[model samples]
Target: MKRQVKPIREGNSEPGTVSLFSIAGIKTLLQFLRLGKKSGALLSMAVATAIYTWFYQWEFALGVTVMVLVHELGHVAAARQKGIPVTAPFFIPFLGALIMMKRNPRDAATEAYIAMGGPLVGTIGAFVSFLIGLFTGHSLFYAIAYIGFTLNLINLLPIHPLDGGRIASSVTRWLWVAGAAGGLFAVIFLKSFLFFVLWALFVWDLFSKYIVHRGKAAEYSCWGKIEVPFDQIPGENWMLIPFSEREPLPYRTYSDMDGKQWVDINWEEADVVHPVKMQEQGLIRSVFSTKVERRWQQTPKVVVLRYQIDYEPHEIENYYEVPEKVRWRFGISYGALAIALFVLLDLVQLMMNEQGGFFHSLRK
Candidate 1:
């Protein structure tokens, strides 16, 4: 079943018609799509959503529409701060807008803020609404605020597409991993019994896909400026020549376009790559991809050994009572199952309400 995700906040509230759909990198997509501006896609989506919801549920629908708008505004706001041009914020129902950016985020700070735009708005809206509800004494108003606030907070919880999850991954991938573990544990401990099975499905998604996804990026801090120059580097390019595969290849081969017969240099004097690095504190463990020797000495080094990111050392160090596998099984995944159960029950209730015949069958 294609489970529909709603922008629900605190308690079980009515779902707004809009859903925000996002994939990892929109910048890359621009290149693929060969489009300088992507505001059109977002605009069209917003218009369609507004039109659709206008015909259907107008009032409850408007809140959803606003949240979607706020989310886009976040992107626009962040982009403006970074001196990047954001075309517009569109309000789309179910599928939200595509924020058109003049350029990609320049740095971590820029990325974090831009990423955080939507949820922050939701948080603010939720809090404001909540406070208003307190004054007006309407439980429903408070519920709306709670929904907005709670959804934003939950989205910030280090799950992808949700602001927090993306931010966590961008900042420190390991922190996000730890957060996942913690979230799993918390869900299990707090047995509200709502989202467990869904959590289990998420766990399965993690293991099946990204667990050992070996995308390793290494930088030796001690490497005192090995200046490898590029011919036509873009102004926005953050230069880090990635040694993806055969790391044994020391980066000594300079441009010989002048046609000089070069000897195969012994580059072993320089730094080497290792998955685990010895630091002032201890062995600094990098995640999944082994980052061979993190500290490249000023001296030359040849095909120093390369290492993939390994979880063994980390798992050993953070040895809890049980493996993450077992820990997650009982956690919010169960709550997800509960959610499924609740849905099933609600469906039954609705059917009974409509027919008043299911009970008759039970009595017979």
Candidate 2:
């Protein structure tokens, strides 16, 4: 007689159903992870959109997001033109979008150039929206245009970390002082806690740099010691070592160690290797000796001496290297753009008040 076995089942489910379900679930999860990793900008934009949609209409939220993206792309374009590496725009729901630099600009002029790109192109984006509002008679477009113009104008407030502040670096440091006052007024006028917090931080940064650490060089230490062979030590008291002769290390390794305060070693000015100093003996003290014996054997002759060297942070000698003509041009362009945006805002407000068609519908 032959014995038969019953079909395998999971809680009355068919055989292999649970296994197939688990495998499919794992595959879906893996695909989602891969998409998240690859589409960071898209994912962030989606998240920001969702958050904004929670508070406002989806159309307005998406339009605002696109405007922010356009502004960031302007920065990206300018950075790439100057051979600088920059990351894609990352959106924050309330704070707006920003791009991070892989490397800092070489001069204040370069910084201003990169900073100016945003508002310049962002203004064009707003203008386009304004035109669309006029053509379609849509209050939504007008609202987006107004916000875009306001955001770009606010960015030109000459505050540190803001586009205006950076542009002022190439123009004049005096603007920073003006920025502080303006920022305080803005905080008060806007009555926004976030703006107040930003203003406070900016004030603290200014105080720390100008008042607390004025004219003082920042100190930094290396993450790891550099190894030099004993035979390679310079015989002279001081000698210059070619920068190329130094070991190549990852840029991130040093950058992470110094919090972006570390500067490359200036071999010509650096005293990397120093000769040993000898001191004269005044008297001889009692010494003990012990006999040590070892079998003679061949050993590797390679020996490395380790050293840790500190470097002063790199500073731009000429912070304002932009020409007088260029500075004037930047100032004029900045002022003109700001004035135009203000005019547009006024025009939009007038249209909303006088026409009251789409704007009234939106209110309803």
Candidate 3:
């Protein structure tokens, strides 16, 4: 016998009023759909839907698109709540969608929550679809459940730029190395062209980080002259020097290098120049180095000698260091991983033959 599924609404709330749940859902949707500069998100969403329609039937395409929309809106809501200005949900045809934050997150924990929002809400959506399929005998509902689950799983693959990867790296920046490894595994095992593309970006980022840390930057001795070519100057446009315990020191620069730029520094400042001994020593070392190299070495190394900005001549390394906060808790992070694994195992069963797969179970 087919199971009878109760409707969410018992009956009419009143003669002329909307139900509480309906109002809440509508308000939530409206809040996230608040399009400021990201009105283009709607256009992208339409394009994605059209493309999916070309690949599948309109009904299937619409269902999948709605699922993705819900997932991205989840991100939008979290960002807004965290007081981070963000763009609306922008969709990509096959690669899914994203919300562009206008500014950096307050901290690693904020970023982790924003990343988690999508999958948490998306999983709920998929589960709702699953229940609908189970009760209504609708294969389309089953497809939505399966596709939603799988898409979220792919997104949580702990690869840099992915939600899971971003969340993981927030705990410790070094974890990006692990993310890179996972990306490589995906490329070799999944053999997906998308994975290959993301992997290429990941590799470039890794190389950039390596060069930033171990190369291009100079440390201050007692007295040293660091001659950086105009082309070799770091922070050609904008520079952000962050201190762990304090606000980031920021600078803006113009691009005008005649030949080379150099800085003469005395290391004595490390002791008495600033109240703090440039805490978080390695914080921006890699970032600044990579930024400089990428800016200057676009083509052949040109020996240019000129001044670019109203340069400040100060000690080389005199910023106070700040301790990095371990925001992501092991228990919460591992819990999420466990849930993802459970979802994956369930997905596998849904695809299997003997376990009555998604289709077979739905048919009954």
Best by lDDT: 2
Whose TM-score is greatest here? 2
Q: How high is the CA lDDT of each candidate model?
A: 0.43, 0.66, 0.56
Per-residue CA lDDT of model 1 for 228-340, tens digit only, reads 22322233432354444333332222223332212222223233221221111112222221233333443332222222221111112232234344334433432343354
Give me the displacement of residue 313 in model 3, in angstroms.
Answer: 19
Off by over 4 Å in 2: 1-38, 218-313, 355-364
Residue 34 CA displacement from its true place in model 2, Å: 4.7
Which ten-residue region of model 3 has the weakest summed lDDT? Answer: 285-294
What ranges in model 1 sit over 4 Å off? 1-57, 90-102, 138-140, 182-364
lDDT tens digits by residue: candidate 3, 1-364 = 1111221121211224655557557456556888645556776788799999887777778878888988888788888889877777889987889887765554556777788778778877877877786677666677777788877876776667888766665565566676677778868987889889997887765775466434443232211111233344345442243212211222222222321122222112111111111111112211011111212553444222111111222322312111354443632663575486477548545643343665554434
lDDT of 3 at 119: 79
Per-model TM against the reference: 0.39, 0.66, 0.56
Model 2, span 16-58: residue lDDT tens: 4445346457558657778653366776898899998897888
